[model samples]
Target chain A: MDEEIRARRAACTDTFLGNGLIRPRELLASIDPETDPDTYGEGGVVTELERHVAALLGKPAAVFLPSGTMAQAATLRVHADRRLSRTVVWHPYCHLDQHEGQAHQRLHQLIGRRTGDPEHLIALGDLEEVAEPVAALLLELPQRDLGGALPAWDDLVGQTQWARERGAAVHLDGARLWEASAGYERSPAEIAALFDTVYVSFYKGIGALPGCCVAGSAADVAAVREWRARLGGTLFALWPAAASALRLLDEGLAEMPARMRHARAIWDALAGVPEVRVVPDPPHTPMMHLLFAASAETFRENARRLAEETGLWVWPSGFATGDPDVVRAELSVGRATLRHKPEAIAEILSGLCM
Target chain B: MDEEIRARRAACTDTFLGNGLIRPRELLASIDPETDPDTYGEGGVVTELERHVAALLGKPAAVFLPSGTMAQAATLRVHADRRLSRTVVWHPYCHLDQHEGQAHQRLHQLIGRRTGDPEHLIALGDLEEVAEPVAALLLELPQRDLGGALPAWDDLVGQTQWARERGAAVHLDGARLWEASAGYERSPAEIAALFDTVYVSFYKGIGALPGCCVAGSAADVAAVREWRARLGGTLFALWPAAASALRLLDEGLAEMPARMRHARAIWDALAGVPEVRVVPDPPHTPMMHLLFAASAETFRENARRLAEETGLWVWPSGFATGDPDVVRAELSVGRATLRHKPEAIAEILSGLCM
Candidate 1:
């Protein structure tokens, strides 16, 4: 059944527990064509969104790209070129390693040196392990795969200082920066100030259509725009995605603090369940991994049944962990999760575990 | 002023000569949300369009990319990897060289060896001059920069055979393949069948949303899909573009033959105008360059005046040729061009030249 749930998800009209973002039809319907006409990778709403994002992140400029994979790679390539070094230091479980098919090396000729354990956050000690000159240090705002874990504030500052001392540019993979912002109690600009470059996804925390923007110095962003054109990220029109992002950003960004609070309450409710475990103990962001002490087959059966009865899409089977008896699913609090009380969601998860 | 016309064109509600493709708002309105939803660069209308394009070009498979720049680079990189040679041979005026900011060399580590004069099409003799092992030979059908010129049929076959004998991949930059097909009086598949890989643009000749597809063997297209993800071209949703392309393709592709006929008629009407010269003398494709003896400054002034008075956008200033005096503009026949009689368009152009 993975195919079965995919089919069901396509047909299901119910609000679900996945990303819970607005669907494309709703997004397209909401966009105002008169004000949001197509832009050839520049000007109009696309440029406006970029400027708005740049100011929010306290950067000199920003360029919109279609994917984080391209955004990060292009940004790092810019940093690498500036420093005249090809080596990039990042965590072992970074999106670049897990998802992008070694694009940094194959496409951009940038070498990656994994500097941290896959199960933990990168430490100052991790940077000390690299014996050679590095072009850039890439850090995820909250380590995603390890269940939204963030290093101590002191460690984060020390890591940036170390990279700067070595003349290495610091880049943040701030894919969920909006959600991560609340836990830090700092504006995006305050947090982004530490890095030389930042990559943020609109589809993730902003709940917009698929696209991303890289923020940095004007020169850096200009270089990224050039690379974006080269990488095919600069479409003839980015207004649809930009308009949706701007609208969703206006609605959702301000609510992130509340969503983070709600996420903790849900975890609190689920803490008593013996068969369920939330990664990172107490959530640092509005996202966390839920480990269920149930077999994949059993989990799929319960998930299917849950969807059939409640019209809720909790866990898609493809996200299961390596062990057949243990499964993992990520919970990213959104409008749908806010609709239900913590007790109700906890009970549903508990039932699945049982 | 250029700025004045840009503002006016944005506000003017008149049909124009440039491109004359479907506007974004109109295209967005035409899309069927009930039948067309989001696809993660996978199934739905996106896949159907890819399959349709693949069949049209007689390729085993096709993958939609967000831009032609990404499509061509990814395809070339794949070919280079397969042959273990990074040198690609093409004309100096190819889009990869002049337009893409040396992305092949900078991003993909591919060395480009420019062959033939920039003013003419590449010949079999041009390939014989390359001293190194070439991974791919990229040919632009109806060379856009050279006034839509195409080599003789035997010469075209000879060039492909030369590349094949040298174990080099032959790829076509068929941005205007639809128009080029009419010139050849051959089906797109018949022309594309001679190459190892073909890149087609939806926004150009097809007048769809900005996106392209690289069609070839299953393995080759699969490799392109991988690079697409790596390059950040794999959008979480491409249905908007796919849906519009599918619709526009159904509407516009059948009219390409007629568009070509209309292009010839326009050229025939302008033949006697001494101040105007159509590039490639006897136009080879539906698209041809119109070189006006008037200076670039005068041309822009005339274009702005014409648009103000007649609500017809002839060409933007950014497309002007290198020379200050001899202005060159490309005309790609579309629905809007079909609206005016050939004599009317010729008279309008002749006035500008004067």
Candidate 2:
């Protein structure tokens, strides 16, 4: 953001948007001052998080990791070592390809095979075409890049079954699993049961500190823990992250349904705005992509105007689209978004079009 | 520890030994409750720390890493990439060889070549034997595994000069550089200037949260920062760790000289005991190894008796030596060790031999 918008954002009395910015005072406020800390990834709050997540996901064991990149790479490497195959299958838009700097191939020597099309997720047909031996298949629920899309329950089951028939391990990139549970109206354990391993994020949707948990069978988890030490994720004290996660997790779990409901309300409210288009019409999870019927320059002007007049920071920038006149923005309806009425938010967002 | 000993340790108040146990309240208590936080390893407190350490070490830049394992590996990898050589030379008992799970070899595809005798720190004579091209030579200050030994200043400069003459980058595993500074009676920057890059720890001697910093030229630090992101050390929030390090680092730095003096006093006191032998005599740093005349079993019995009678937790176990008749224990004197008079501590330690 430029100086004027930055100043306004800082001075704004209350945020109409929240990324759960972890201010030191705010982040530790929820944790006990005298809480016992963990040592070297074992005991204390780290163990508490591991056990809580394992039981919540109905897994025999779980290990809290410092990040998801290490968690998934280490998990997949374990599966590869067991199956004696280095190939992993996932969507073309998977995080391993785009965000992780290809750490799997560089660090683990595991080959990544993009099975499904980039514009869509893996279907049973996509899995059938993979005739070669595969170590594992990774699936992201409510695919964020696809505007929080989710597969039908039957399709999801069919896809997992196909991977199993081929003797391949199945893993879930359940970073937003809480949202998925709310979307499917099913318990997290029910959805987690179909996978060989599941990785969940505490910071993204939950608004807790940065950390993640990988849950699976005891042996797999033990293997991952060993890998965690090798990757240098086994810290001397993980209590700060673990304690924050433990304190806010149940609250996040309970609040996700409401967030999902608010997302739908947002879509309904936006339908009246002629210049805005909501992906999937209604969000499958708590997040969605909004295509604006305005140029990037025009969107900036509208945003700046709203910040000056309404004293609200809408967005710093909007992503450019293929067409010069259109722009795209992603909206993940959080507690802050819930505070303002959907109609009021839509009214402010419409200004971005003009 | 067994149930009884564990209970005793828990109940004991005000220890004569400190390892900076980072209980949440105690760790964060020093920071302003209203301080802003850093995001993804950038800005706010992490920036403050990076700048502070860089200036202290007289380096152009520095980047904070979650663990020393990642910090050194990433730094070595960058040096290797620049030099196009895979082999890194260090002592046989270097952390990379003894502690890490061979991550440099496993993850970075970098070969490690031991260059010195396990019993001694690397000397100029050791550097002369290296015929093949090397990417880097890692030297740990006040080598912990070797009873906190620091190379003589002239010899240290000569060794680093030899590595540079061979077109190899010199890296300092300055994990205990604070103590080394006290031992050498020189500024940290004075010693750091002999190496191309230096990695320092906060949790070990500083009593801060678990983390470390690699300081060097701007280009090298920028590269390590990229690797940190790929390694997943770049968290959504690093404020807690950075803030803790920033708050406690100066105090730890200031305390090292006094701790070093107290270490000398402890050695003098131990001289009066017949069964206890202190390594390096007067001490090269604020830490040393204590060789006991008793066997492992005898040491445990004496330790138990002391804890039960004195209500002070002591050694739960001691290392078995080749003789099996003698045991060894390491002591890194800190603020806690300084609290008790050196004579009193030696009197207590002497009982373990009986």
Candidate 3:
């Protein structure tokens, strides 16, 4: 629970859920420069990757940016500009609301109006309470903060239509859309079709170097490109990240459905444990939160001890639940989790609780 | 030039004055991951690099950002917030003024008031006429757009004093500070000490990968870091660029003095040519503007022909001179330029003009 013990566990563990802390050369070695000549990210591998992602998302065009924060902000700003409104409606737990330090207001000069409860996904009834004409309504696929829970398909469609009827653009903060798509049992493009602009991250489920692409209409993407340049999101060369993303796209996407199945299997195994509670009851996507009915100190000590003995690393500290007794850890099923069977992990959890 | 001709010329050239459009593998080969592990740019190589840059510039602290555009915008906004002023004063040709598509106004909510003549550097008297209190006075060392021209040191000091006396912060847009330092014949710290915030680019005269560091007081740098995260300038791994920058910093800084000498030598050799006019006459830094007494069409044709014949790639089009009969090219001397002697370049110029 202390800093020294936390440091020791991190230093000793080789287990991480995603792309797992690659060394510079190992990360670079994964990229093929011969097939991916560099540009100022204009017309080389970046453009190729953009086109491929655009096609996959069923959008007219796409532009790659260094981060999802910039991509989403730029996309929503473009949507807002078209409608000449400065207000964006979204759930309070959306990344733009919490993680981005109010850049939506400070940098983009847009005001955010929260529409849904932070602990749950948006409902159709949530849109009816808006008092002003909104520029855009941002929807996060799978509602990451709520353990990747998604609204029902009917409600999802109705939400988009609700915003459209108000002349508000629908934007998707689909940072983990690849993993979420498997839960819906639909192609990414089919889910993406519900939004006017969709921002997907390559780093999360794709296991690529950090980068993202905003896919939308050609005109909108062009505007985002201009904003990308303005936001300093245009890199001198994105080929390295683009090459890595291209290699992961098909592989990562194909693996997601299986990963989701693996997640469900793990959730089912753990459900019988009295000390463990899986958020959303059944896993909605490849990710879900596990809340331990234990103190933070107890959770950290047990996780550290388990890692030291088993060489399987888990987080030392839980994401805050604002409750002293309940500790939360997000389980994102990836190649790393595939190494441990669901039954074994469930047994470990039962042992840790004891 | 025709596509085939351009392709043929490019095949044999070893080019590049500034970092030279690095291929992915070649760039990767230059980095050592074992020594520089991947990070979200926390306390690893990026922190080390930031410390080194801050010390080099004689600042208390520094934070790395993905681009100069973001670095400057964030820095100026930080200054503006402290002063509760939203207006910035700078040269008409400052990068923030010309290149950034008014991101200051659009994103940062800061209005820019252009000062000084675009054809010359800022004079001390120029600051006196500002009718309103300003948030910051941004100075670009070696006034890049005006043939790398710099104001005399006394005038530069007086200009900084003038802004400070008015309770405004002074920020340095030192993208080419390494080369510009040679013009002042002063340590970088000496120049940086004249400003409250200074931004240095790694990809410019340093020839590193694309990135920048803003050096200032610890609090300001911390604010910049916060803005960096908000701007999504925090990469999952910034080690590659940081390592590349550390490699170049000492080498580039050492080479800059000689590079300045080489620039002047080349300028002097070409000064006697009837068709050529070297801006700033003797050259201010390792870069200067070469104006030709020819139309853009003529200049492009001649430069293309020379490249096709000599396997030397000159810019296809000259920088805008506002005169249809005149064209300009900026010559930035570096390791690549060292291969061709000043006399040879002059001879080539003479032949091309003929």
True contacts kept of each: 0.74, 0.73, 0.72
lDDT of 3 by residue, B80-106 (tens): 989868999999998888998888888
Q: Write the number of the candidate with greater lDDT, choosing between 1 and 2.
A: 2
DockQ, all candidates in order: 0.60, 0.66, 0.57
- How does chain A of every candidate compare to the true chain A by TM-score? 0.96, 0.95, 0.95
Top-TM-score candidate index: 2
Q: Chain B TM-score for each model? A: 0.95, 0.96, 0.95
lDDT of 1 at B54: 94
* Quality class of the docking in candidate 1, CAPRI style: medium
Q: What is the per-residue lDDT of model 3 for residues A170-236, given as tens digits with 9 covering 90 to 100?
A: 9999999987799999999999999989999987877777889999999999999999988888777
What is the iRMSD in Å for candidate 1?
2.6
User: Which runs of model 1 end up more than 4 angstroms from their true locations?
Assistant: A1-3, A15-22, A36-39, A318-324, B1-5, B15-22, B35-39, B318-324
TM-score of each: 0.96, 0.96, 0.95
Error of model 3, residue A227, in angstroms: 1.4
